[model samples]
Target: MIEIKNLSHSFYVGKKGKEREIPVLNGISLEISQGEIASIFGKSGSGKSTLLNLISGFMKPGSGRILINGEDVTSFSEKQWAAFRLQNFGFIFQNFQLIPSLSTFDNVALPLVLEGVHASQRKLRVQEILQRVGLLEQANHFPNELSGGQQQRVSIARALILNPQIILADEPTGSLDSETEKEILNLIRELNRQQGITFFIITHDEEVAEISDKRFYLHDGALVNGGVSIEV
Candidate 1:
């Protein structure tokens, strides 16, 4: 569950000696229910990723309140944010951000390792999630040996290995072919349906938006619907 109230963000642009605030989000307010699949569509530089970063604690909001499951996290310290993210959120990226050198098993085990999980337990958990993502047989393979879809599956397994309550995916299907994208999207939907994991996906793909339970578009740092059809 997520609750955002009157959220706003901006960045300083221009020369170092002379900068001005360039607002990205203005008075954003929205709530995402548990287990719901939600998509936010927007053009380039429309602040879609900004909102995700704000929610995930990658960057603090300039001004506003962000509550996860009823706890306000607006002022959380860096240490607190790190702990909270590890315990509550999983992240998937467009590029499938896996280490080129790490084997699939090791890649998926990174989170557990960071948490100081024992070797045996980490192996078991990694195996389980790899199997769930249909990557069990490729456990020992390196990123370079796998296809794009397979690589993305590895990323998905890594994210799901911790069983976090929410998954924040940015452009999840961006790099895959259309057919592969369909498979990945289906996998995401299946995971949401079977595991009840909430998905907050920011994507420019209409096909991705179609699979979501709720869809909204971002325009000039604000959310809008019913008038201009969201191309993204």
Candidate 2:
């Protein structure tokens, strides 16, 4: 459902007149099929996150093309990207990225609210997703009131609230304990199995990579090990 071709990106550092180019991704090409859980493993500065950002439309690649669900999104304008992302993508971050002031329900409902859904419909959708993530009881809680795992569940609920076709997770379990990590991973697997959602995860943990249908190793801004599917 996702494809990257000849993707490369660089950043410039130093003063205005005299700057140096630091390459982050180089000729990266990969494809992820619908309903598959794929992961990219890399150490710091390996460009794994950069690849995700480019695909996310948060940053543009210096040279390359990105296609999602047969639509070429490489040159999508900001407005177009916003609309497309709302319909097709959900994002999870290492930090959970939840607004501390919002209740779990509101946090999960934010996307629907942005899309202009009515209150009654948003209420049902948010409650359903929160229940699926096992956070219905915590709906009234604030971020600071919940445990790390619970907070991450809130993040997952928010992501799933939109019924996105693909979820881009970055170090999804980074803030949790080992047991909690396992729980989150299992939840991810369950969601994929039941809903046929494609998952593209960026993480450094071997345990996280273990759950993936396909694994890729990134090093020095390139794929050191081809993104090959593993026999399940």
Candidate 3:
């Protein structure tokens, strides 16, 4: 579960010496329930990615509170945040973000190995997730050998390998062809339905929004429907 309060973030723009401050998020706030899929839609510079970064602790908000499972992430120390991210969060990026040198299986197993899972157990779990993402046969292949969709599937497997409570995906389907996009969407939707893995994905795609339990719009750094959306 996620709870955000009065969240705001900004960055500098213009020439370095004469830069101006531009706000990316302005008092945005919302809550995402366990097992829910939420999509954020916005224009090119509308701060959708910034909001995801804030939630993931990659970028700290200037002012606000972010709570995960009732733990206020704003209060986390550097090490604490690292631990929490490791144990509770999974990420899928538009680029797939795979390590160029690592084989698919190794990349998928990285998270579990980082958690100190035993080698045998990690191998089994990695294989299981790769199978889930339909990448079992590609296990020994390097990222460069895979197509865009396959690489993204491996990224999904890497994210799921840890079994994190929440998945944060930024344009997971952005780089694929329409048919491949459909495949990825169906995969993610089924994962959400069958495994109850909550997802908060930032996407410009309407089809992605349609699959979500609900949608939110971001513009000028504000969360649309935040105040008026009923609890039910």
Among these predictions, the greatest lDDT belongs to: 2
Question: Which is the leading candidate under TM-score?
Answer: 2
| Candidate 3, 102-181: lDDT as tens digits | 99999999988788999999988988898888989999999999999999999999889878999999999999999999
lDDT of each: 0.91, 0.92, 0.89
Rank candidates, lDDT, best first: 2, 1, 3
Please list the residue runs of candidate 1 whose C-alpha ends up more than 4 Å from where it truly belongs after superposition: 15-17, 225-232
Q: Could you tell me every candidate's TM-score relative to the true structure?
A: 0.95, 0.97, 0.94
Of the two candidates 1 and 3, the one with more favorable lDDT, higher being better, is: 1
| Candidate 1, residue 231: how far the Cα is off, in Å | 17
Candidate 3 weakest lDDT stretch, 10 residues: 223-232
lDDT of 1 by residue, 145-228 (tens): 999999999999988988999999999999999999999999999999999999999988888999888777888888885323
The sequence of per-residue lDDT tens digits that candidate 2 reaches over residues 27-116 is 888889999999998898788889999999989899989999989999999999999999999999999999988999999999999999
Query: What's model 2's lDDT at 44?
Result: 81
Off by over 4 Å in 3: 13-19, 226-232
True-vs-predicted CA distance for residue 176, candidate 3, Å: 0.6
